[model samples]
Target: MSINDIIAEKRKNVEEIETKIAQLNRKLSFSTLSEEKKKIMEEITKLEKQKRESEYELQKLQNERLNELAEQLRKRREQEKQEERLSTVLPPVEEFTLRVCFKCTEKTNCEAFLTKNRQKMLPCILSELLNH
Candidate 1:
């Protein structure tokens, strides 16, 4: 359950305890129900303690959620700063060398062109015929 829901439930329980306590007080005033009054008072004490515990738990959950959000924000900011640094440090795309294949009309970067040319240096027979 959400923190607000937990808090509302606990408050409702506390209100119920208070209402019972009031009823018990009225009964005690009217008749000699000492034993019943004692039991009700003990129950009231337990309920009050539970209410305090609930309030403490609600506050703890709220603080934990806030801390989690703050941590995520910190991580996001660090990631953005790292990205900015990378963008500034890296070379521009236009500065890199490019090559085009005469036979296949394929375009590629210098590294890829070197690898492809190293694999097969000769132009295709069909390309030579088309050129002639």
Candidate 2:
């Protein structure tokens, strides 16, 4: 089962244990015999321990879920930052075409013009062309 399902089940178990303990306490109050009261008290003790264990497990699961969500949020933020950096480094499509592609005589079949790093080199190349 999923963590959420497990957590819900544990919570339910804790609640049921609490209810049982309450019922046993009510029964203990009405019991006239010493043996019957001792037996009821023992059962209540066991149920209370079980309730404590269930509550601890529920708290652990909730913390784990929170950590998972925090990790996902961190990764998404990093990806968005990387995309923003790329967008700032590269000129807009229209400006790149006008500044570099239109001015270059070898528009087609030019290795430097068609290479992946052309965007990085475009500014330097354009500056050299302007100087000449």
Candidate 3:
């Protein structure tokens, strides 16, 4: 996915988390209740804490993504300089490479890595090659 796509996805996730936090708070606002209220309060607190942590992570990712874009622009300018100096250079897009997360396949059974989308299964490589 593009960087914009990633940022959009993160924003959506943040919004979902915020909605959950709000829902938890609304649930917590009930005054008249049995011991269940206390249990609900505890769960709300946990959810709020988790939301805070996730917000922090989202902020970190936003900053990192901005920095990565700046660095990429800088590298592109540097490459232009090298091309001017050397008279031979590759384009920025050609320089990029993707490395698969083998561990992600093993652990989560990542659907994206699979050759064929299955109702239930990891990539074929995980079962066939990795023998797991």
Candidate 4:
């Protein structure tokens, strides 16, 4: 059951105990009064104990749910931080460098093109990757 439902049930039990105690107090007389009072007190104690147990269980369940949500939030934040770090600190493709032929496409030397146009092509390649 939900925490609120458990708490409401606990409150109901307490109210019942209080009603019983009040009734017992009203019915108290000289004959057998002590025995009846003791019995009613015992019943109240048991009900109170049950109420405490229910409250404890409710708290435990709430804490478990809170912890699970907290863990999920923490993991999501950590993942976002890792992504941010990667985006800011690392290039899109580490194994490849930007090399484009400015003169002609046929029989172009990629290494010669990269060495000559590295400064100009770097920003264009990074922007394309970012947009993609």
Candidate 5:
């Protein structure tokens, strides 16, 4: 049938074999010599092999999911950088040189100059702290 159906069938078989092995181990603890006892020991070994294979398959599926998540994070970062460039918004930079002129007694003439538009440089609220 489908891929999922195949995996489901394999998993079910593994569980059934494991249960059979557990039952056989319980029977093998006593001194016995029948042909059935030898057959149960062989079956237990086979079920142990199947259990290892199923565990490996589960680990492979988990690894694939981790790789998919890493790829999605890379794609998202690229998209955000492209959008920022198209909008023409400059990245923030330090304005360590912007200070008020020394023509006033108080610090009510502070300004924050932005490279985006010189005309948009408004008075800074830092003036309030200075007056207080």
Candidate 6:
């Protein structure tokens, strides 16, 4: 079962145990026999322990869910940061095409020319050529 399902089940168990304990306490108050009162008290104590264990499991599952969400958020933020860096480094394809391909003598074979002469400083070279 999923963690959420398990957590819900645990919460239900705790609620049921609490209800049973409340009923047993009511019984204990009404009963006059010492043995019956003692038995009811014992059952209440056992149910309370079960309730505590169920609550602990529910808390653990919630913490795990929170951790998983935090990890996903961190990865998404890292990917966005990487994309931002790349955006700053590389001109958009449309901008490159407008500034270089539209004006090049090799317009008919610009794709081939660009592939063969690809360089880190291609924008700078294009700017110098355009200036002259």
lDDT of 2 at 28: 96
Candidate that would win on TM-score: 6
Each candidate: RMSD? 10.7, 4.7, 22.7, 9.7, 11.1, 4.5
lDDT score, candidate 1, position 6: 65
Number of clashing pairs per prediction, in order: 0, 0, 0, 0, 0, 0
TM-score each candidate.
0.48, 0.69, 0.49, 0.47, 0.47, 0.74
Instruction: Report every candidate's CA lDDT.
Output: 0.61, 0.80, 0.62, 0.61, 0.59, 0.78
Instruction: Please give the TM-score that candidate 5 achieves against the real structure.
Output: 0.47
Model 5 lDDT tens row, 30-121: 63877877887787788788788876775565566567778999999999988888555532223312442232233334333323233333
lDDT per residue as tens, model 1, 87-124:
78743423322212434455443334556443343443
Q: Please, what are the lDDT tens digits per residue for candidate 3 over residues 55-88?
A: 7877877888899989999999999998786644
Per residue, candidate 6 scores C-alpha lDDT tens digits across 41-112 of 889888888888889988999999899999999999999999999888766655755566545656646763
Cα-lDDT of candidate 6: 0.78
Model 4 agreement with the true structure over 25-131: per-residue lDDT tens digits: 56554337678778766765775676577667656766776887899999999999999998777555433343223333332455535465555546545664565
Residue 128 lDDT in model 4?
Answer: 49
Which residue pairs clash within candidate 6? Answer: none
Q: Is candidate 2 or candidate 3 better by lDDT?
A: 2
State, as a TM-score between 0 and 1, how close model 3 is to the true structure.
Answer: 0.49
Off by over 4 Å in 3: 79-132
